[model samples]
Target: MAISAQAREILDIAVAASEAKLGINPVALEVTDRMPFTDVFLVVSAESPRQVNAIANEIVDELIKHGHKRAKMEGKDEASWILVDCRDVIVHVMLDEKREFYALERLWADAPEVPIEVTPR
Candidate 1:
C-alpha cells in the first residue's frame, strides 16, 4: 500500500511537533504503508513517561491546530505509550523503556523510512 501525500504531510508535521515540544533523542518515526487502517505509523520515544505524555498531547494539539483532528487516543493515562490516531496516520509516543519493549521498528522493518529534517525547538 502506497502512502498518500496527505498522510505523508501529516506524518511530517507530527514528527516536527514531537521533536520541538519534547526534545527527545533518537526519535523513531516509522511509516507503515501496508497497514489497512492507516497509511503511516509514527513511533517516537522520550526519556521519561512525563515527556511521552507531553509529546503526545503537543503533537495532537498541533495536528488539530492545522485542521487534523485526532480520530482516537489511547494510553495517555499511563503515559508509557500514547497512541494518537488521525485516520491516515497513527502516532505512537512512548518512553524509552516502553519503546524498547514494544520494538515497533522491528515489527515493521519492511516499511521504508521517510526522510525527516530534524530541527531543535
Candidate 2:
C-alpha cells in the first residue's frame, strides 16, 4: 500500500527528530497503509532506556508543532517502549532490547517497506 502525502510528511518529521536526539542506528520509520486506524507505523530503536524516551518525546513535540494533535501516548515511565498515536500515524520508539523482543518489523512485514533516508549527525 502506498503512503499518503500527509502520512509520509509526518513519518519524515518523526525520523528526523529521532535521528537528531538519539543518534542511534538510522531509525526505521515504516508506512503501513494496511492498518485501518493509522495510515503509517513508524518504528525507531534506541540504544538505552533514556534514549528511547528522548526519541519518543522529540517525535511527539515535532509532530505537535507540525500541527498534529496527540491521540495517545504510552510507556513514558519505564521507557522500555513508547508509543505516540496521532490518528493518522503511530510512532514507536523502543530500546534495542525491547525492539528485538517485540519485532514490530516482522509483525508488519506484509506492508511495503518505505525507504527511510538516513542523515548523519
Candidate 3:
C-alpha cells in the first residue's frame, strides 16, 4: 500500500526523534493496507528503560512541535515498551530485550518497509 504523504512525513519525524534519542535497529513499516486504522508502524529499540521512555517522549514532543496533536502513549510507566499512537503513525519504543523477544518486524514481515535515512548521531 502506498503510504500517504502525511503519514510519510510523520514517519520521518518519528524516525528522527527516535534516532536523536539513540534508538537502535529502527524499522518503519507501511501497514496501511494491513492495518486500516494506521498508515505506518515505526519500531525502535533502546538499551534501557529510561532510554525507552525518553525516546517515546521525544517522538511525541517532536510530533506535537510539528503541529501534530499529542499522541496516546502506553507503557510509559513500565518503560520496557512504549507505544505512541500518532493517529496515522504508531511509534513503538522498546528495550533491546523486549524488541528481540517480540520481533515486530518478523511478525509483520509481509509489510513493506518505508525506507528512512537515519542521521549519524
Candidate 4:
C-alpha cells in the first residue's frame, strides 16, 4: 500500500517538530503494506529521557495545532520510549539507548523509507 497524502502531511509536521526539538536521526518508514493500522512509522531519538519527552510532546502539540489528534499515547512517563499514534502516523520518540536496543528500523527492514523534508519549527 502506498503511503497516503495525509501520511506525508503528518511527516511534514512531525519530523520538523522533532528536528526543532533537537531530536536525532529521524527516520520515516512507509509501513502501510505491512500493517493495516497506520501508514507510516516515524522513528526518532534524543540523548536523554527528558529530551525524549520533549520531542514527543512537541510532535503531538504541532500535529494537534494543525488539527491532527493523537489516537493514543504510550511510554510518556518513562520517556525511554514514547509512542504517539497520530491516526495515519505512529511516531516513536526514544532515548538513544532504547532506540538502539529496540532497533525499529531493522525490525521494519522491509519497509521502504520516506524522506523527511525538514524546516525546523
Candidate 5:
C-alpha cells in the first residue's frame, strides 16, 4: 500500500532527523494496510541506549516543531526501544541488538518501503 501524502511528509522530516543523529538503517514501511492507526512505520536503529534516546528525541522535537503532536510515547525510560506514535507516522528507535532480534523489516516484509535519500557524509 502507498503511504498517504501526510505520512510521506512526516517520513521525510523524521528521516532527516534520524539521519542527523546517525540513526542507522532507517526503514519506512507503509503499514496502512496492516495497521489501521498509523499510515507509516519508521524503524531506525542506534548503537547504544543513549543513541536510541537521542534519535527518538530528535524525531519528537522535529515533528513537534513542525506542529505534529505525538499521540503516545513508549519505552523512553529503558531507551532500549522507543515508540513514538504521531497519528499518521509511528517512529521506532531501537538499540542495534533489539532491532536485530525483532527484525521489523522481516515482520513487515509485505509493506512497501519508502525510499530514503541518504545525504553524503
Candidate 6:
C-alpha cells in the first residue's frame, strides 16, 4: 500500500520541526510495504546528543500541536538515537556518529524515499 495523506502531512510537520533545530540530512522513507505498523520512517541526524533531543522534542511538540498523538518515545536518556513514534510516522533522531554507524537509509535502501522540500536556512 502507498503512504496515506495523513502520514505525508505528519511527515511534513516532523521534517519542518527537525529542520528548525538544524537537524541534518532528513530522509523520509515510505515503508508501508515493509513495516506493517507505520506508513513512513523519517530519519534525521544531529551533531550532538543535545541536538538529538532537541530535534526529537521539536518533532513531538509539532506533532502534538497538529492534533497528532505522540504514541511512544525511546532513547531519550542516551540521546544517541531517539525514536519518536507518531502513529503513521516514526521519526528517528540520531547523532551523526550513530547515524553513520546504523545507516538506516542503507538498511532500508529498497524502500522508496519520500521527497521532502527542505527550506534552506
Q: Which candidate is the best by TM-score?
A: 3
lDDT of 6: 0.92
Q: Model 3 Cα displacement at 81 (Å)?
A: 0.2
> Who is ahead in lDDT, 4 or 6?
6
lDDT tens digits by residue: candidate 6, 11-107: 9999999999999989999999888899999999999999999999999898889898875899999999999999899999999989899999999
Alpha carbon lDDT of each predicted model = 0.76, 0.77, 0.92, 0.88, 0.88, 0.92
The local lDDT score (0 to 100) that residue 86 gets in candidate 1 is 80
Q: How many backbone overlaps does candidate 2 show?
A: 0
How far does residue 13 in candidate 1 sit from its true spot (Å)? 1.4
Q: At residue 33, give the lDDT of candidate 6.
A: 88
Show how many residue pairs clash in every candidate, following the order shown.
0, 0, 0, 0, 0, 0
Ranking of all predicted structures according to lDDT, beginning with the best and ending with the worst: 3, 6, 4, 5, 2, 1
**Cα shift from native, residue 117, model 3 (Å):** 1.1
- lDDT of each residue in 16-98, candidate 5, tens digit only: 99998999988888889889889988999999989998888888889889888754779999999999887898999999999
RMSD of 4: 1.9
Off by over 4 Å in 1: 23-33
Name the 10 consecutive residues with the lowest summed lDDT in model 2.
Answer: 23-32
Tens-place lDDT digits, model 1, residues 32-120: 53666777777877888788878888888888888876657899788888888887878888888877898888888878766566775
Poorly placed runs, candidate 5 (over 4 Å): none
- Tell me the TM-score of model 6: 0.96
| TM, every model | 0.85, 0.86, 0.96, 0.93, 0.93, 0.96
Better-scoring candidate (TM-score), 3 or 5: 3
The candidate, 3 or 5, that scores higher on lDDT is 3
- Tens-place lDDT digits, model 3, residues 25-109: 8999989989989999999999999999999999999999999998999998899999999989999999999999999999999
